[model samples]
Target: MIKNAIYLLFSFFIIGCVSTKSTLKNVDYKATKPKIEKGKYVITEYANDPKYGYNKEYPINIGFANLHSEEYFVKLFFNGLTNPEGDIFSYEKIETCCPFPSNHNKMGVGLLHKYRVTFNNGTTKDLYINLYEKGEILCPNGFKILAN
Candidate 1:
């Protein structure tokens, strides 16, 4: 119980430090959710900008509002991608960083979830995800959209 309390307090303290303005560059409130098939998101476009998802300022904004779990959306998003050579990929959330203001959360702030994606060929890259806002779902550079 003490550990849980300490964690909660630490979380509050971190959230309290968020800036009043968000720095995310890709949040689109009018963006529509991607279609899901075979437990994966159906992504058709590749991000033209190299910084998309790979930079903290341009996280892949998969909003949590219409979903039950933010992690579920993260999985679906990754599941729809593969290496350029069509090799399957695996990913894990390695860290949460880059707090920013967002009205979507009860704390009025949100943090970016950084994921480490590993391809079958032993290559890895870090991608940042934002759960507090919506944006176009696209395959990042160095990756391809899984065929439907």
Candidate 2:
């Protein structure tokens, strides 16, 4: 009796997790800012202005190479992001989506997308490298937020 009830509860739990599907659409970003050479984009002097606070001046590029299709990648590059003071901070999540290349195969090359953010203390961070197809990124990696 108890065992049967536990099994039923476990099955419902698994079903709840499986019901959620990814709701992401492909994007064709317009060049609102100047393009960088060598396939990189630069965000210069972002801290100097308030509008670009979340995204500081940095360089980024998107292209195909040394990666596999259907595989999304998320990498974070930073200097002194962690501090002893532990001043907890939060930033809005950024989303980027790339379409699957036509030449994609089980073993195909990958595309790269760079999002660079520079700090006021001369620290720089790069997020979302080769994040093609679709990927999820949470900044200050491994930090989970509690829901209100």
Candidate 3:
């Protein structure tokens, strides 16, 4: 009887600690609807909220002109973490302000990128990135809001 009681207690404790990781797969970001900024860059949650003391690294894909080769092909992957408040965020991906070449689609477009990010509640957010250049780069904020 004592052994059974102990087992029951242990099982209950373990169940309480069990939790699920953050997976953006099948997550309806569209339903949530991202907040677009001035018809430019769009900001949205990474699925997992990494606020407070909890933090996780997310990966990003960067493509640009290879200055060395004088060609337009470059790829980089890196991990970045979220801020404490969850409002502020940063990634290892390179943020470029320069103009993309005319033939950027040949290299920069149609790339499937993946990143494993952790959230505030010990959950992980898997990010898939798809990059491209739109129109004639209107202004500094011409990047435009990327629709999911």
Candidate 4:
């Protein structure tokens, strides 16, 4: 019984890491603040202004080569991000949907999203919105927001 129970738990954890349609879709975005091109990423900034806040504090996300795809490529740009001056920007994984919370130990879903990135010259920041099929511009020139 103990071995069976442990196996069940492990299976659930593995399943939970796969993000499905509903999980990655449907994030709310602000109309006033639009997506912009900053460094090698096109991202939507977390509106810091109180009037446009999401009532949540999260890091600005950046996107690599997989910004405009429906399939989760699970890869990053080999040549990391750089600036107009050729300085390489650095990033830290601030958050991860790592060990996802399950619903009744079934129907598990989660995604690895959210990050903190600092651009050269320290000019702009924002996060990569991973909701697919919405025509978000590919990083480097494409950024978009959740439609109203």
Instruction: Give candidates' CA RMSD values in order.
Output: 2.1, 13.9, 18.6, 9.8
Superposed by TM-score, candidate 2 places the C-alpha of residue 58 at a distance from the truth, in angstroms, of 20
Per-candidate Cα lDDT values, in order, are 0.88, 0.31, 0.29, 0.35
Instruction: Using lDDT, give the best candidate's number.
Output: 1
TM-score of each: 0.90, 0.23, 0.25, 0.34
- Candidate 3 residues lying further than 4 Å off, grouped into runs, are 1-103, 107-109, 133-148
What overall lDDT, based on C-alpha atoms, would model 4 receive against the true structure?
Answer: 0.35
lDDT of 2 at 61: 26
Clashing pairs in 3: 22-124, 40-144, 40-145, 49-120, 50-119, 50-120
Tens-digit lDDT track for model 1 on 1-148?
9999998998788777877778999999999889999999999888999999999999998886533586788888988988999988888989988989888887788888899998888889999999888899889999988898
lDDT tens digits, residue span 1-148, model 4: 9999998897777676554434332233432222333312223332333321111222122222233441223223202234545565655545544333323223443334444456656655444333211222223422123222
Q: Model 3, 27-137: lDDT tens per residue?
A: 222232223343322433243332211211221222232344211111121112233433322222223222222234432212223333444455444443323221111
Better of 1 and 2 by lDDT: 1
Q: How many residue pairs clash in each candidate?
A: 0, 4, 6, 4
Candidate closer to the true structure by TM-score (higher is better), 3 or 4: 4
True-structure lDDT of candidate 3 = 0.29
Query: Which regions of candidate 1 are displaced past 4 Å?
Result: 1-8, 65-68
Q: What is the total number of backbone clashes in candidate 1? A: 0
Error of 2 at 97 (Å): 16
Q: How many backbone clashes does candidate 3 have?
A: 6
